[model samples]
Target: MKVCSVSVDLDPISCYYGIHGLGEPPAPLAHVVLQRALPRFAEIFQRRGIHATFFVVGSDLASDPSGRATLTDLAKSGHELGNHTHHHRYDFARLSAEEIEREVADAHQVIAQAQGSPPIGFRAPGYDMSARVLRVLESQGYQYDSSLFSSWPYYFAKAGVMGVMSLLGRRSHSVLGDPRALTAPVDPYRPGSGPFRRGQSSLVELPIAVSPFLRLPVIGNWLLVAPARVRTRLLESVRSRSFFNLELHGADLLDADQDGIPTQLISKQHDLRIPLKDKQRAFEAMLDRIAQDYRFAPLREVATDVQREGKLRAGGQNL
Candidate 1:
């Protein structure tokens, strides 16, 4: 069956601040994504009877009891808890090998404690994955890594944003990862020895959902903000792919007014500017539409199925 694995990256508000070159957020806002927005995602998935994957930053779980509790509950509810690194540094792919291992191991330890087992899936911070990072995952015995985003449109747009921020004297924390990643396979493949190429490593690289030709992202933030007609077109573009790795962030469900998000953040984060109700409606509509063509499963399950069937080769082609 065609698979649509919806995964949420539970990035804290601080990550966004860093991305925009804004300094640390207020103390109370530290856990806002986990405390306020997490439950909203859980409710939405629960209503739809979907068990999704949640990629978590380890420090959030270690520092906040509420975050730990929420994830523990989600794990019990059959959701897969995956590691999203410890500090969520956007420069993760550029870090030293030791630092990368520390980030992955620290997150793995804490997520295991919270979820009762080691997380089999991993997503690098800022969607930046490197050979060094891949080596760390291999050492940790990870089943899959979903951090490779191979959309040129997304990459160029990010580069443009960071460039503007730089010219404006605001150094955004986001990185313009390996340009070669823009040419990586769109489907699931076992990464070879490097970042974007197919390899013999046991780890499967599930690139984020992108259109076949234009390679535009079909992610939550874009889908929610895009005009209905455009959104439908984007969705249709990826309808034939056997795997739909729909990625979302905790901020997608956050409301600027109702969630008490500060003007500073709401002004920069486009999706946060939309009302929570509207985002919720758009997300549900997207899910319902996708359900017609694919069955929803957590990334762990999809990875496992790929492994057992031995369908994916080094070139990401199905045998």
Candidate 2:
């Protein structure tokens, strides 16, 4: 049977501040996501009877009681809460091995404390992963990593945007990871000794879903606001893959007015500009199509299913 996985990265507003190069605003922005957006997400998933995965940032959990409680509630409701590094650093790929280890371990403890168990899955901050990063995960006995996004179109476009941001004198808090990541597998694999190449390793890699043609990302960050025609074309390309992963961010469900998000922030973020109701409808439409076409499950369960298939890690122990 064809399989699908849906997951979200619950990075708080501070991460966005870094991404936009806003550089620590004088006053903190209320985590619009924690207060409203996440509740909306919980409602949608609960109504749909979907047990999705959520990658949680460590420090974010430490920030507020409400956010922590919300995340704990998600775990209690049967959704998988996975690891996102402690600081949500955009340059995770550039961090030293010791720092990487600290990041993963710190987040693991924080999440485990909130959820009553340590996470088996991880997604790197900013979708950045490298051989060193995987080694850190392996050391911690993580079962899977879903940060490898091998999409040239997405990568190059990001580079271009960052370049323009630099030229315009805005300090984009993001960085372009190794260009080699674009060559990573379009499907899940057991990352061997190499970063992208398949091989024997205790840790598995479930890359972010990308359209095989032109390597466009098939995730909510792009599709939730993409025109129907564009989304339709992208969906067609991804249907051919055996395992499809749809990744979303906590910011996807926030609105400028209802969520009290700054108008300037909304203006700069393309996806956030869409009306919340419209975005919900678009997401539901896509989810309807996905449910019709494939059997869906939480990402950790999906990875377990993949490992059970005996397709990856030849002669390599099942992850």
Where is the poorest 10-residue window by lDDT in model 2? 310-319
Tens-place lDDT digits, model 1, residues 149-267: 88888899998998899899998988888888888888888778996988788888888999998899899899988999999999999887878899999988888887688899888
Model 2, position 116, has a per-residue lDDT of 89
Clashes of each: 1, 0
> Which residue pairs collide in model 1, if any?
192-199
- The numbered model that scores best in lDDT is 1
* Predicted model with the maximum TM-score: 1
Superposed on all Cα atoms, the candidates' RMSDs to the truth, in angstroms, are 2.0, 2.7
Worst 10-residue lDDT window for candidate 1 reads 310-319
- As a TM-score, model 2 comes out at 0.94
Q: lDDT scores for all predictions? A: 0.89, 0.82
Error of 1 at 79 (Å): 0.2
Point out where model 2 deviates above 4 Å.
Answer: 25-30, 312-319
**Native-vs-model 2 lDDT?**
0.82
Give the per-residue Cα lDDT of candidate 1 at 3.
83
